[model samples]
Target chain A: MLAMRELSVGFAGGLALRRATLSVARGERLGVAGESGSGKTMLGLACLGMLPEVAVVTGSVRFDGGELVGAAERDLRRLRGQRIAMVFQEPLSALNPLRRVGELIAEPLRLHRGLSRAAALDRACALLSEVGLPDPASRLRQYPHEMSGGQRQRVTIALALACDPDLLIADEPTTALDVQVAAHILALLRALSESRRMALILISHDLRAIAAVTDRLAVLYGGDIIEEGPTADVLAAPRHPYTQGLIAARPTLSARRDRNAPLPTIPGTVPALAHLPPGCRFAGRCPVELPVCRSTRPAGNPACHRGGP
Target chain B: MLLSVEQVHRSYRMPRRRMFRAPPVIAAVQGLSLTVAQGEVLGIVGESGSGKSTLARLVMGFERPDQGRVLLNGQEAHRLPAAARRQTQMVFQDPSDSLDPRRSIGWSITEPLLAMGLRAAERHARAADLLARVGLAPADMHRYPHEFSGGQRQRIAIARAISPDPALLVADEPVAALDVSVQAQVLNLLLELNLTLGLAMLFISHDLAVVASIADRIAVMHHGRIIETGPTARIVSAPAHPYTQALFAAA
Candidate 1:
């Protein structure tokens, strides 16, 4: 349903995404995992043709037989909220504080489906209930502030699904919610994608959340797809040093290690965009940094000198 | 126990909108009690509005409990002398926010020492030593907080917290704001410090995995009360409380 080939995005001096290639089949869920400056969000935005004007983008972004790169503004706008939807990390700020959630959700319906206000509102209530929000009728009248963090996120999800888009790009959708609420939101996303046969692009910094919902995993590090494979396979034995570091660094809920021993950590911070290393972005902090890793960028998915499936 | 709280209850009065109406009371901590022995880490795990932070404030003597007492080394924390109070320090969630951006790292680390009437030169030397102890170079002491990364800033915060050689350290979601890889560095540092310095820690966080990793005993809080408290192994393996089970499942 979605394919990105050699999609590169660059600013004045630095590259945000470098020759990144990714694809998601219909009803498939792909997880893009990366830290603060990894440019995972850039990849998501690029898919929807939402990169800022200052950002120079190249290569092909094909979604449902349409090329998004250099597409006309009117065409992009038509596809943005109607055919390709997005859910952000912070729902409170993403939603309008002054507008009623019903109107907000119904606005897309009325605009795209050309429905009357009353009819769109009725559909909006159904969507609210579909996202598992209780008291859907009364909730339509409430503002974003009146709801809990989880409810607000649910409303955001409802708005994204309002147009029944073929693909949904959820960027860190549950990062701000509590653990229980996050779990519920992930489950809802999973179920919705499965039932609706919608392709999902879940971008998150958290490995656990990614591991929970995604079928395939793409590990991004400093604007590159360092690893891509089945989620279970990659998680069971991560080949890339960065992937291994991320997995080891996470404190598992079930596995209890020695309390006195220090946890294994990736030394050095993620390099700033302007100061990124020439070859492998992670080489500076990688434990098994080869000399060649400093001069030549590794090619292909699961990009690494060391052998990994 | 190195530190203990007995039947502590804390509440805040909401401002009344109407002149004739009485202000409503919201209990932040209700009959909460726990302890941390010497060199033992007691993890306080709770979601937002669960009163875990309120408990930390009460333990640090930042807020007084309306009903019960918070005893640190058999003396009330709020009632302790100025010098004695330095024995218990806190490491906040955001190191950048807690540390003054204008001051040098050395100046920030040695502030507690200066308060204890130490000479300026001695304080500077101690600051350098503290930085080295937290796996940072002594030269980093002259740099400001903004010069360091999130993990390094947390190290600076930890160095400052332990500069006074406090027996107890209350870290309230210290690693919550850091990235995963950076969070591991900070968590490991705390674990190492606990072992090397024999410092007791009250590790408060909403992350169950992180709490289970470092805590000797875990206390699960909900709606201003502790629902369950037990050894880390017991809590992870077989939680008796339904809320604890739910928390584990959620994590």
Candidate 2:
């Protein structure tokens, strides 16, 4: 359904993503995991053809057998909502406060499906119900602020699903929500994707959330995908030192440690894009850094020399 | 006990629609009571609107309870004199907002010391010492808050909070605004402070895993009430309350 080859995004100071490549088969669920400044969001934007004008993008982004890197704006717009929908991290800001939620959900139907206002609203109510919202009709008349955070997110998902896109790109969908509510939303996304057989790209800094929903996981660091494989396999024995540090740093509920003991952490912070090192960006912080890693950049999938699953 | 809250009930009156109508009352903290001994860390875990922040405010004496009392060192926290009230200090979630942008880092760190009648030279010396203890250079005291990264700003905030040498440190989601790697750095700092300084801490956060990692005892709050309170090991291993079980499951 989607193929990205050697995609790189360059800004004034430095490149955000470098030679990043990925592909997603129809109905496949892929997760992109990385910390801040890892260019996870940039990759998502590239897939949607939503990179800002200032961003100098290279290489190809193919969707449904059509090239998207240099596609016309009109064609991209048609593909954006109708074939490739996206749900963002912040639901409150993504929605319009002045507009009633029902109308907002119906807007996509009107634009993509060209339905009348009444028919679009009816479909909107149905979509809301399909997303497991209670009293869907009354909710349609309520504004975004009137609903709770979880409900607002549900409405956002309803908007994204209104057009029945083939692929759904949910970037940190539950970052701003409460734990239980986030769990419910993740469950909703998983169930909807399974039922609809829609391809999904779940991007987040959280490994547990990704583990819960995605089948394949890609570990991104400093604009490079350090590791990529089956989620369970990669998590069970993370190959790259960077990926290992990330998993170790998370405080898990099941693993009780001494309260006074310090958690294992990556030594240094993520380097700024402009000040990236000569070779592996993670070489500065890797626990088992090789001398060769400083001068030679590892290429291909699972971009690490030390270990493999 | 270093800090004790006894049957505290805090409520706020909602805005009235008409002149004749009485406003509705929303109970932010309802009959909540907990204690923290010297050198102990208490974690209060709750979601948004679950009344955890209200409890923090009540403990810090920022808000007076409608019913019951908040006692620090056996004295009523709300009725304590200014000098006595300084025994407690708090670390907020967002360091960028909590630290004053207009002032230098040194000046901001010494504001509490100034209130304690310390001289400018002594305050600066103490601030320098604190800055070093929190893993920053004394030279950084001259820089502005914006010059530092998110993790460095949090370090500065922690230094400021500990400069007062308060008996209890109320850290409300101190690492929530930080990245994962930076979060470990800050959490390790807090744990080190708790050990070295023997400072009692009220560590409040919504992330169960994070709270479980640092806190000796944990309290699960929901709808303005602490539904469960026990040792962290027991709480994580076998949560008795349904809400706690659900929270663990969700986590």
Summarize candidate 1's per-residue lDDT along B1-251 as a digit string, tens digits. 78999999999999996899898989999998888899999999999889988998888988888999899989998888888898899999889987999999999989988888999889988988999899899999889988888889999999999988999999999999898989988888899899888999999999999999899999999999999999999999999999999998999
Model 1 Cα displacement at A36 (Å)?
Answer: 1.0
lDDT of 2 by residue, A215-294 (tens): 99999998988899999988888888888889989888888987757988777678878877768878888878789889
**Candidate 1 lDDT for residue A91:** 99
How far out, in Å, is residue B45 in model 1? Answer: 0.8
TM-score of chain A of 1: 0.98
Name the lDDT value of residue A263 in candidate 2.
88
* Tens digits of per-residue lDDT for model 2, B1-251: 88989999999999996899898889998999899999999999999999999998988888889999899999988788998887889999999987999999999988889888999889889988999898889998899998887888999999989888988999999989888888998899999999999989999999999999899999999999999999999999999999999998999
DockQ of each: 0.84, 0.80
Task: Please give, for residues A161-200, the per-residue lDDT of candidate 1 as tens digits.
Answer: 9999999999999989999999999999999999999999
B-chain TM-scores per prediction: 0.98, 0.97
Model 2: clashing residue pairs? none
Output the worst ten-in-a-row residue range by lDDT, candidate 1 chain A. Answer: A300-309
Fraction of native Cα contacts kept in each candidate? Answer: 0.92, 0.79
